[model samples]
Target: MTTKRKPELVAYTVTGEGEKAYWTRIGSAWAHKDGEGFNLDLAALPVNGRIVLMQPKPEGDAA
Candidate 1:
């Protein structure tokens, strides 16, 4: 069966190899919304990455 792609909440970190120690959110994929949406903490990753929110599986059998 084919699988569908969904959003997910994730945390990313940049890897500048100790050269560039800084990271900023790229693009306008998401915006600040209090404490209800994705709170990306790129202090660790130090690189631009995505923090998605994966869709929940359909209720019923655990495929």
Candidate 2:
């Protein structure tokens, strides 16, 4: 049997640089059982932006 786990990180499409950067949520990633790699699920792929992985924000904390 296989169990589903919550995503360990959130994926974002980043544009610009430094303080003027923009981050948009684009996907999520889950670690493999062996911790060797991750599986990424993206809702929208970017054509000219960088893809970044970050830890998800805590519940109810909107920045």
Candidate that scores best on TM-score: 2
As a TM-score, model 2 comes out at: 0.82
Predictions in order: lDDT: 0.35, 0.85
Q: Give per-residue CA lDDT, model 1, range 2-43, as digits (tens).
A: 213322332333335466643333212232356466433232
Candidate 2, residues 1-63: lDDT per residue as tens digits?
A: 133776899899888899998888998998888999988888999887689999988889884
What residue runs in model 1 are displaced by over 4 Å at the alpha carbon?
Answer: 1-36, 39-52
Tell me the spans in candidate 2 whose CA falls farther than 4 Å from its real position.
1-4
Error of 1 at 38 (Å): 3.4
After TM-score superposition, the amount by which residue 15's alpha carbon in candidate 2 deviates from its true location, in angstroms, is 1.0
TM-score of each: 0.18, 0.82
Error of 2 at 59 (Å): 1.0
